[model samples]
Target: MWLNAILGPVSSPVIWVPASDTRKAWSSNARSSAATHREVFCSQGIFGGFMLGVKSISGMAFSFYDWEQLELIRRIEIQPRHVFWSESGNLVCLASDEAYYVLKYNPDVVARARETNASVTEDGIEDAFEVVGEVNETVKTGLWIGDCFIYTNSLNRISYYVGGEIVTISHLDHTMYILGYVAKENR
Candidate 1:
């Protein structure tokens, strides 16, 4: 699913491109949410496909792009939900009120996630974000007094392994998400 949003003048329609050999995907509601240029997050499926999270006019819309007979999966009931890609390439969506849910398109990963918790530790933990034991950099896992959260803004490093990289996924948010340190920086 190759959905691209081209920011033209101001009323440009959002286009959805199908990822198929035939390239036979139509654009529905092209002018949907033309008022605001909302950022769309793409998540890779475990079954060799992808899902699109777009801020439609109605609300936050999730739909399958490449799969057939695909309809809108879920419509987030938040005015402005925070959605991002998970470590497994699944969609990690969260509402402003802290309603966290993962829209998993990967059957294999979803099956595993459902059968067992992805946490490496065996202490009855579900959905644990693990930091591999091989980093030698300072990782800020707490907020200081009057501290800002964004990685670039707060000058902090968030290390999460995904897609063959230790990408900085979570920033700081004293109110919403909690930051935790897995291990100390190697000396």
Candidate 2:
């Protein structure tokens, strides 16, 4: 299935363009949060052919965009203080004030939605995530290594987490942020 894309000026409405064939593309008069152009949040979906976190009146809005139903923005009900996604876009870590969750986006849902040529229901997109792995700690910032999550916390501790379990732990002299990871050097 060809993954469609949402385009057009942020101030106006959104245009859903089929990346493969612009001729079949259609536009929507409905407003999207993208119109606000808020920074410090929002990431394009890397693995799932969707968009990640976006800010909404409800704090943070999570939605999925696909080719079949290009107009509807079915939202998942969850607000996180911060969001960290993987390079390939398959994995995401959502952080709140007290805990963080690691979610693996399931591509099968997108495939099924395309096959049926139906709009993916809200529950469909929500079920697209593997059971979220939660850890009871406040994360300041984080990065992703494959399915693993590496982060620095409010306690000034650097921890490597696999499925939300601490695999290795270390302390930082001062609070430091994890910019990114180099897969080649494994730094």
Candidate 3:
């Protein structure tokens, strides 16, 4: 489901909702007094992954779930923080200024649990990130960098192609970015 909100002084306020019935409750924010405020807190839980806290204000707070439970594992009093899943299902939280935290899960355990499991196939070689080039394709997608390759959709032009190479380029148009190369496998 998709949601959009516009806040401002208008003649008539309009609320739009999807047709589907699936819905979840979210926290709300309010002001208590001139010097105090009430904030609605939220978090995201990706099954078999991590839990990340979602706050309303910028540069206010960030959190990660405990390794065992998808609950608030650690909370940091910071500002302008963002959290999301990396390429490998790892929880990544970006905190104050330029600070970042990356977490990963055990692949062996995950693979064995699936009913139809197969050998884990790595996209490319171990050092696949070292190759430099340009983005040959521009997917309206996201990327992440972990113990391996990380793709970022918001990372603007010069970005990494998950399971591919890293390129230093002139410009990242729909075609010019060389994601990865077809070289001999050295595993």
TM-score of each: 0.30, 0.64, 0.35
Among these predicted structures, which one has the highest TM-score? 2
Candidate scoring better on TM-score of 2 and 3: 2
Q: What does each candidate score in C-alpha RMSD?
A: 13.5, 8.2, 13.5
**Model 3, C-alpha of 3: deviation from truth (Å):** 12
Global lDDT scores for all candidate models: 0.33, 0.58, 0.33
Looking at model 2, the pairs that clash are 46-89, 47-89
Q: Which one wins by TM-score: 1 or 3?
A: 3
Q: Candidate 2 lDDT, tens digit per residue, 1-187?
A: 3332443433332332223332221123322433223322233221123343343444455554443434333355556677776767677777778888777777777566657756566444445677468888899988878777888999899988886569647887898998987879989
lDDT of 3 by residue, 3-94 (tens): 33222223222221123322223322321110111222333211122332434244344443333222233444534233434545543423
Q: With candidate 2 superimposed using the best TM-score fit, by how many Å does residue 156's alpha carbon deviate from the native?
A: 0.5
